[model samples]
Target chain A: MKEKLCSLQEAVATYVHDGDVVAIGGVGRNRAPMALVREVIRQGKKNLHIVGREKGMEFDMLIGAGCVKKVSFALVSLEEFGLAMNFRRKAQAGEIELDEHACNSVITSLRAASMGLPFLPLRGMFGSGVFEVSKNLKEIECPFTGERLAAVRAIKPNVTLIHAHQADKYGNVRIMGSPFEDILKAWAAEKTIVTVEEIIDNDEIRNNPQLTSIPYIYIDAVVHQPKGAWPASCDSYYDSDIEEIKAYAQAIKSPEGFQEYLEQRVLSRRD
Target chain B: MAEYTTAELMAVCLAREISDGDRVLQGLYSPLPMMACLLAKRFHAPNMTYFNTADVIDPEPKKVPFSTAGPALQERAVTYIPLWQTFDLAQRGELDLIFLGAAQVDKHGNTNLSAIGPYEKPKVRLPGGAASAHLCAIMDTVIWIPRHNNRVLVEKVDFITGQGYLSGGDAREKAGIPKGGPRKVVTNLCIMDFEPETKAMRLVSLHPGVSLEQVKEATGFELIIPSEVKETEPPSPEELEFMREIDPKGVRELEFH
Candidate 1:
């Protein structure tokens, strides 16, 4: 088996490129691959197309750092802290292209990619204003039932980034709780880079193979980074750092403050 | 009558929407619905299958977490159901109830959580609606607007993130939605329901101390007020106590602010 373990900087630099389509792991503030995301920003990658369902700070920070030019997502918010200010500001200013979708459509699109299909039929979003702005969605009649369904175009991201609780050197990953679309994302993307809290022995992974969420076949690189999902909870590892998130939210209220935040928190960090 | 905060009253009203065996799902940033679900399960709807954005099934959290998607919800769950599977349940017409917050709501019941001004160039890009489009068509959607004002209760939304009665009577049906749409809209001031004939938002009941003139003044669009409007029942002592028991830190009040 090929040893897929590498440093975070090398993994991101080699796989993630300028203007590549990227899908981030985690939902909201849970198990976000912050370390990998920060590295992508740190490397000064630009014009990347980000895709996800119900993203939060991960997507917001990327947009804040000006790394993203377009986003195809269902929702992006900081939950209780309020709207993702950076996303709201950039979007309001028409700085980023929005391929806004309903959450179901995003899921169906990823599913289509995972299945190697051109598109998948969705049941809802017919009269929704989201159906109006979504350029990739089309109305198709089911051949058998003659039912009108929304056909969501498949989204195959160039690289998928994920954070897992544990993994082996060969990249058999075990996500502790709520593997929110991470598995589907890995299967849909051309390459997948997982940052893990710890890299365990391959024998241990093989001992309990059923616990492995994503097998070595799907993963391209595995970067062992402790506290990879910092500020976000890792489920059974640590709770979300609400104060830090709140402070970050406050810091990004202005464009100058957002840049200052990047300098102090994200850009200043060493790999 | 028992003394209660507006948040407590809203939570109790939302809790009453659940039946014994309804399969309900709560979304992210929904502290009020989270409290309501716990209160319902503990009281009337013990058999209802509760699900959250965290993918936990029938979670028995000791206390409501600050974030609705927190790990506390996963602590004592019966099992796990990924979001796709939950969406599948809604598509299959098995999921009964869901609560969604709206940035703006029209008289036709169409909600906009997308953008305030226009799609191409928005004045304020609100948080995109998560699963509202799909689930609002299939599940019995209960919308909550914490701040009831002219800005929120618009005559027509700029964008329809969630399909309600789409331009009124039979429009939702013509759109080929499988089943279910907006059932009841609970706000801080009053409870509103759709008029059966016109599918327009109609004032049903007002919360205690909230006047008919106040609701009329707050709504941007003309509401179909019936000949008589009832006052919303205040939270009972038992309900208020149970609400405190579930959310002692008053997380339910977070959205109201």
Candidate 2:
């Protein structure tokens, strides 16, 4: 196997391209690939179509930085702090395209891509207005039972970005807790780039093979960055830096403030 | 009656709804419901299976974490169930109850967490509904609206992010939904349930100090008052003590603030 270890900048630069459909791995406020996301912002990648299940700071920051042209998501918000100001602002202003989906639809779509299917049958969202607005979903009657089902189109992203607890140089990853759709995203995407908190020996990963969430075959690149998911919890590693998150939430209230946030928090960082 | 915050009162009321052996799930940004589930597990419904947005199954966290979607929930968790699997459980009909938050809710309990005005050009682009659309259709949903006013309680939602009774009477069934819809709506001011035939929101009970006139004034649509609306029970002293023990930092009050 080719050694996939590389720097965050190189991994993002090489794998993530302009206008590529990028899948974000983590769920809300936990294990987001922030270091990789910041590099994507700093590199000035544009017009990316972002996808995620339940997103938070990473998606909001990407939108605020004007890197995203369209977003396909079930939900994106700052949770307790408030609404994702940038997303709310840009969406209401019609600056970005919103392909709204229910959470299950996104999962089912990704699952379809993972399984190499054109579309997958889903149980719900038939009567809700979300079903009406979602252009990718179709209602189909099951042939065997004549039961109604929503068919969600497969979403095969060009790249999937993930943050995990540990990995080997060859890209065998160990996600400590709650591998929230990261493995599915990896399988669904053409290329998977992982940013891990630590790089361990291959023997350590080999010793406990069952702990390896994403094997080397699926991962295209592995970026080793400690505290990569700062302001977002990494399970056993550390708790979320709520103070910094609050600071970020406070800073992005205005356009100028958002730029300043990008400069000081995102762009200025060297890792 | 013991002195209790509205948050505490709401938590107790929500806990009362959980029955033994019921499989309950709570999504992100939901401290009150989290507290209620924990409270229920500790008190009445020990056999109830609990799930959170953090993907931890039956977590016994020390205290309610500031962010519901974080590592704190993983502490002493029985097992891990990722978002997909949890939704799968709902699809398989194993999930008994779900607590969902709404941005705007209508008389029929149709929720709008999608947008305020229009799909393309929204007046206000609220957070898109995560699993509300799917779960509300498949399983029992207990909606919690932190703020109760004319703006939130509407005649018709601008968009239905979650299907409730749809247009009322046989609408959900006609739409091919097999089971489950919004069961009850719990708000800061009062508790509301759907009328059996019309499926419109009806006044169930008023919270301790809130009045019938106040509820009528706050609601955007005319509510079906049942002539005798009882005052919602205040949180018991034992309940208050246990709630304080669970949430020493008052994390549950953050939503109210």
Candidate 3:
């Protein structure tokens, strides 16, 4: 088996190119690859398009860093804290293109991409006004029943990044809790990078076959970085830093505070 | 008189709306409904199947979850799902009830969670439609508003994130949407229900200290107020105690504040 281990910076630099369409795997605040995302920002890549099913801090941080040009997702709020400040401001300022899709439609697009299909038929958008705005959505009549269905375009991202609980030396990933589109995202993308909380022996993976959510063949690279999902919860490991997130929400409201946050938190990284 | 906070009142009102054996679902930023669904499951509707948006099924968290999407909800789950499966269940019509919040809602029950001002250029770019637009057309949705004011209760939403009763009765059916639609709108001020014939919002009851004039003044559109509107019943002592036990740390306070 090929050795796929790498440093967070090396992994990001090798896989995430500027203007590349990138899909990230996490829901709300669960187990996000913030370390890798921060590194992407540190590399100062521009015009990146982000594909997320559900996100919060990671996307907001990336947007605030002036890295994103377009975003396609169901929702991107800080949950209990408040709205995603940078995402909201940048979008309202017309600095980034917001391709809004319902959470289900985004998932359907990923499913289609994973299945290598052209499009997926869905029933949710029949009468909804979303079709009027989202040009990529089309109303097609089912050939068999003549029923109108929304044909959501497939989402095949150039690269996908995910944070897992554990991975083996050969890159088999074990996601303890709800996989939440991470596996599907990995399958759909052209390249897959995983940031894990721990790098365990292959025997541990072999000993527990059922916990293997992503097989080694699918993963392109693996970076062992504990607390990779910091500020966000990583299931069994730690809970989300609600206070810090709330503080970030308040701090990012002002330009000076946001800059200070970047200086203290992002720019002054030890590793 | 036993005093109750607005959060407790809202959660209790939402709990009553749930029926026995209903397959209910709730998303992120919804603490009231999470508590209500759990309360309903514990007391009135034990058989109610609950989805906590954390992908957990019937999550019996020892403590109140800080956020609905947090991992704490899955502490003692019977089973769980991938986030995609939640939508799959909604699309297949397996989900019976869902709780939603609206940035703006109209008399016709049309809802907007997408943008505040306009689609392309918004005064405030609210979070885009996650599952609101799609789920509302399929399931029996209940709208919850944290604050009730004229801006939120508009005559017509700027963007329709979820289709309530579009124009009126039969409009949803005419538009090829599924039969079930929005059933209620629970807010801090009062509980409102949709009219059977017109599909317009009608004031059912007002919370304690909330006057009829206040509700009327707060609503942007004209409401169908009954001649003898009743005061909303306060939460029972037992329900309040149970809620306290469920959310001992008062996680619901974070939103109301």
Best by DockQ: 2
What tens-digit string does per-residue lDDT give for candidate 1 at B1-257? 67889899999889989999999999988998998898899889999999998888999988788878888988799887789999998888889999999999999888999988878888889989988987877768999999999999999999899999999998988988847889899999999999987899999899999999999999999999999999998888988888888788889999877
**Per-model C-alpha lDDT, please?**
0.91, 0.91, 0.87
**Shift in Å, residue A56, candidate 1:** 1.1
- What's the candidate order when arranged by decreasing TM-score? 2, 1, 3
Q: Fill in the DockQ of model 2.
A: 0.88
Per residue, candidate 3 scores C-alpha lDDT tens digits across B37-88 of: 9889988999998887788898888887786878888888988787678778
lDDT tens readout by residue for model 2, B136-251: 88989999988999999999999999999999998999998859988899999999999999999999999988989999999999999998999899888888888898689898
TM-score, B chain, candidate 3? 0.96
All candidates in order of DockQ, best leading: 2, 1, 3
Query: What is the clash tally of candidate 3?
Result: 1
Cα-lDDT of candidate 2: 0.91
- How close is each model in CA RMSD to the real structure? 1.1, 1.0, 1.3
- Give a tens-digit lDDT track for model 2, residues A1-271: 7899998889988999999999998888899988888999999999999999889999999999999999999999888887788999999998999988989899888999999999999998878988987889989999999999999999999999999999999999999999989999999999999999999999998889989999999999999999988888899899889898888888878878888988988888876
Please tell me how candidate 1 rates in CAPRI terms: high
Over the stretch A1-271, how does candidate 1's per-residue lDDT look in tens digits? Answer: 7999999999999999999999999989998999999999999999999999999999999999999999999899999887799999999888999998988889889999999999998888889888866889999999999989889999999999999999999989999899989999999999999999988999898889989999999999999999999998898899899999998888888889889989989899874
Pairs that collide, model 3:
A103-B130
Q: DockQ for all models, in order?
A: 0.82, 0.88, 0.75
State the displacement of the C-alpha of residue A118, model 3, in Å, after optimal TM-score superposition: 1.6
